[model samples]
Target: MKADSEFKKVLTLFPVVLFGLAYMVPLTVFSTYGIVAQITKGLLPAAYVVTLLAMLFTAFSYGRMVRAFPYAGSAYTYTQKSLGSYAGFFAGWVLLLDYLFLPMINYLLIGIYLNAEFSAVPVWVWILLAVTLVTFINIRGIKLVANVNFLLILFQVLFVVMFIILSIKALVSDGSVQSLFSITPFFSEDSSLSLVFSGAAILCLSFLGFDAVTTVSEETIDAKKTIPRAIFLVTMIGGGLFILVAYLGQLIYPDYNAFIDPDSAGLEIAAFLGGNVFKSLFLAAYIIGCIASATSSHASVSRLLFAMGRDSVLPKKVFGYISLKYHTPVLSTLIVGIAALAALIFDLETVSSFISFGALSAFSLVHLSVIAHFYIRGRKRSLSETIVYLITPLIGLTLCVWLWTSLSSSSFILGISWIVIGTLYLAYLTKMFKDKPPELTFDADEDIKVSS
Candidate 1:
């Protein structure tokens, strides 16, 4: 496409990675820390490690696809261009579940934490405030959003680092510095592979927004290189932070059963490690971090809708329209903010699982797209190439499937229902196979590269 018709390529590496981190929301490591600990039987670090490795594999596949496509579409573009139109439509549809609902889930999570701290404000009020603030920020534009995310991510990281330091100090004062290092965080008498894997499945939700970096590919400078690098960096840095926080958390609060409220376990750990002062600090950090997350989620989902709409998969007049002044998909952005209001009706645990299923399902398709694009279509027959194209993505695909199986039955029913709805819509769009699915028209001069 002509440069004038595409997203402005202004973002460099740092801001892009910050956007991804903001979307991932570093403080979320603690938000769900308690529940993951219970699942891992107190070996939270082990669970994080497993989840990180799986995410890394998926991140690699995403990087490969980003290099090949270098466009606005995320897994949808990748799968459609590499696999087929129908598969691509379904991939985009499944991903909509993640992109559209994520803001709601984050708003709900922040509401839970903030409500626990200030019950008089009411959680629904906080959710409303979050939707309003996040929607406004996103509609403003990507550059402004990136600048805001840089500050928000800095606050989240500082809080997490301070939390870790305080927890270590508490451990040392009780005994000595030696107490800071404990094998119990990774392995305890009750820990098992199955439990850790299950925990890893749930923990996968923390990695949801990393791939969202790809949604802004059109706006990224040197997108073919920058998008892939940002994906790997976000996954590694975010995963490392999660592992460290979980380790220190387990060390400070060793027993899962000891928590007064299993859902808010990190709160108890905050109190034990740093008293009421730190507990209050942690709550504030959690709320801001979630705000940052919702902001990024809104930005991403809006872009995805723009891509689909531009392709005529969605209503071209509405989702395809961009605000001439703000330079954003205003209608799409507003729809997301409205959808997030569903948080008022649903609880945290259920919505979180719902987001996970959508993300992992889309991730699995991305991995398959890599295999289909590289191994089957490219026809490159080399040992290293084979490993990169086939075996690596195979591992990623397997992990995504295993995680999908680990989700609750309700998630399956709900997620499948969403897909079924999408399938019907796709049929309508394709006219029951009488016509091809809608696709973006590219300029003949566009320097698009196929990985093959």
Candidate 2:
């Protein structure tokens, strides 16, 4: 396929709309607890501040790379160019572990929500049904997916707005919360440093799905501009909403702690004002948002597979196949659906620590890719571009390493195990394809040698 033709497939209003909604939900609801916890513990708004600063560094690195390469391969292409093929493939490979789990998380959460009302239908049934239903829709073209996302996102956004409105009504009835900030200490009186860190780290999970936009860069028209802008725009929108909703909860729900427990944890805050009725509504919203999360994940993983196929890292036939009618990856989509469903049967809480492991690792690589590219190509190239690509990635690397250390031991161990598995798979594929007609474009860089 001509590059332009392939890229054009991703150009649509649907992605933009889905992204806008995803950004809002996580920030408004999820971040309320974590961000507030971080702020209270740090004696200020450290979580929100850290998030913006961290994203700025990472986003800039992404912008520079997308403009330079502007291909659908994203991390696969950039890492291949800077770190070499093995590094690129493994970087892309490990990410599969994290993204691969998204559908599981989504479907599982959706089932739990549906159980609130439909006591008759088991939550697992709802999960299976949701995955089965969405799988066929995704098999259609991205155009249809995007169209559906636009409506789904609209409802998601509406639910959040409604919650805020209802809570505001309660606040007005009780007079005002203008002096409420004075009541809570700037620094946490209860939480230890470790507890606050763990809490803040959770926000990264909510922050992640938007990066999937890059996986489709190969299909996006004007992606070099649209993708990056969409990211920053979404972040600001979500960030502002997070801050507002946290304050709203604090203001309206005086006894906020009652809502949170081991079962619901950070989310019980929604139950306070909503009561039984509002709880049901927000619960529905949460599940729907998770479905959106699964949809976003499905779209992303298939693109990753598509790119891997292009590099001949996977069975070129399956991963590389695009539906002529839909211009989407049919087989890869099916694979993602099946894999996600498989994860559902697992007791993932035992493995949930590893969930964000590969994603952070991939983000780390992306940052380093920019630095490495400039460290090599910069001296012979434009100085400003070099600084944009290299310096920003260096900052991103520092932030990522800091966040990496903050991960739990369980996560670190599971993450490491996944990498080892990826290495073995790469070697097996390499040997199997050794006699094949097409060969992978292995990097010439000596530094990128595969461990196998």
Candidate 3:
């Protein structure tokens, strides 16, 4: 491994989008369908639409920031450069909660699913097996990860398509074509705008992958253009899949109260749509989806660690070192793999609480960064620039705050504790504010061409 080695620029827009969608795990809409359906009073599609519009505002901010700093580290890099080193450090630190634990959630999902299917095999074995496989693919390189994710995501999409077709068939068999065209999924006498917003807050987590694409900017060609385009495409495509699936699911099973269990409602719907065999296939697709999500998130966190390490924010020797032969961050990937083993001890609910906190925190900072870099600092205050840089991000920040208020008390406790620890570390690293924290170096000749 060479400390100075750069990542190979092998990714393009298509694979990058694949990585984002894989990280999102489009089939996730099925897993949470019942709970969201209940929350929205059967208006899942309306909730998804609200969530998508909110995410796009933040996605637009990400696009703006990536053009100015087309590097790895995502929000960490953007906030550090635009907002001051301290704010940037906290942004990266809090984001670590989201990036670091997401793979653990996937690993836990694999263990739980596999253990249920094959009771003879221990859950830890499945967790370890998944962690090993994902870690190995990530260590080999991003291209292989992208290729594997493409196949996994392809399976997920095929399953979603099958699910949609079956839902439509079931609906038509029971009713008429008019049954498929009802606005009840988007709005009904029982649902209200407040309930839709509540559901939107919950569904916001489904759009996590769009920002994860920014982590691979260093390994992407013409990253300034490609990364931003991939962000919007991923957000729109992922949101589209979620909204469509929710709409169809609501149509097929309009009576949300009929579910036996809200948490396992997807399984119930699967059983109804395709019977035992299709239900088994659905389980298999879900396991594959978990693997795909774990791999992408594993790769993402490793790159984020590498970025922080390269700037001497973390240990330069351990976290900063990239494999010369593989062009991947070997140590950082291994560290994430090891961290994922905690899945053996932690449950999904506990791990999930930390994710929304970190994601919302990073999103809020990115919006602020856009205003700091483009509006206040650059003095681009023309009417168009004001709308783009100020008003847009202001709306984004407000939505993030709204979502933040919806987070659980556990999320606040865990997130605040993580931030406190990070603050102490930053103090020591910067010698009690007597010194400025380390900064990422961007070379002038590095072809970081910004587009409007």
Candidate 4:
């Protein structure tokens, strides 16, 4: 019940930070370049400067919420605690899309990357191989998952550190100092500011691993302390690293588009700097990073489904079952696996923006929840907490609205439709399971009645 106790557990910040580095690296490089044309009108550095500031605003709200709740469910947990069940369900549902499809996206990228390494092998084979291995590892349990993540993150962070150092060296030796600020005018003479910011806002989607860690809160030891610390460290350090990489990208290749080919952005950057060896290294790191992202994402979807089943808001028999042997959520992980693979087959550009929309939607609610819980409820959070909770969330919400609007009206309709479907399902299940709430007295030895 105490706020201070949540911040007590020991975490070195490195392991806390390790899980997110995988998701952040590739996401930053690929997603950022997609928006560069709009922001810099082909100039890269100017666009990134704008992006760094926008990311900071959203991250502030995320950091505060993690400290506040420090529970499982990430956005799902926070929204339910503050706003009530229905709102929480929508938050969880939208986020399910983000988590469900991520492995597919990672697989798709990995498949493509591996195709170059072993040209004869099909990408799907590699995808199947990667997912098979990861699922088995995840099935082992959160502790093993964490260990896998710790190692993946270690490799990824080392790669990135080497990258930054190499990039700085290459840029300094090969290019002019003045080029750093050469593309200062981000909002080109001809471009619309609204559109440019929108693109940049869209680019911040890659900087979204902060709250992703929150979804793993249940499996975390001393979650109240560990979760918040993880959130802050990942966002602040990772966000800064992303910006540094982006800027280094600009420094290494003032004309970034030319340096990074449309098909292989990270590869081209590596090629532009140090040729095949460096490029190959970057690709290897990028793939490892994507796997890290998938690992965290896999854990998130499993936990979300587990929570829903516990609430009796989902099919208790289908989603409720945890792997007895591994003590991990079993059915939920299977469903997520199927969904992520399916997402790859029908993969749409709209999915990425929608991912951002869902993430920010939940993020907005979490920030609002902080205000509702700690401030409006007259709980223990200080004025500083109150201000951060209120102001930061509002800023993040407004940013969400801006980016949400930027999506084609079709994405808006799809986004809205998904929530509506989730609501109806939630209501149906709520009514069906109305009287079936899990009882404290219900013995594990007794009949485990599961409502369909």
Give lDDT tens digits, candidate 2, residues 275-350.
Answer: 7777667766677677666776777788788777765677766787777667777888899888877745765454
Give the Cα RMSD of candidate 2.
5.5
- Model 1 lDDT-worst window of ten: 443-452
Q: Per-residue alpha-carbon lDDT of model 3 for 60-155, expressed as tens digits?
A: 999999999989899999999998888888989988988988898889988987898899999999999999999999999999999999999999
Model 1 per-residue lDDT tens digits across residues 173-226: 857678877788888878798888888888887997679999988788888899
After aligning candidate 1 to the native by TM-score, how far in Å is the CA of 40 from where it should be? 1.6
Q: Name the better of 2 and 3 by TM-score.
A: 3
Task: Give the backbone clash total of model 2.
Answer: 4
Cα TM-score of candidate 3: 0.96
lDDT of 3: 0.89
Q: Looking at candidate 4, what is the lDDT of residue 74?
A: 72
Clashes of each: 0, 4, 0, 0
Which structure among the candidates has the greatest lDDT?
Answer: 3
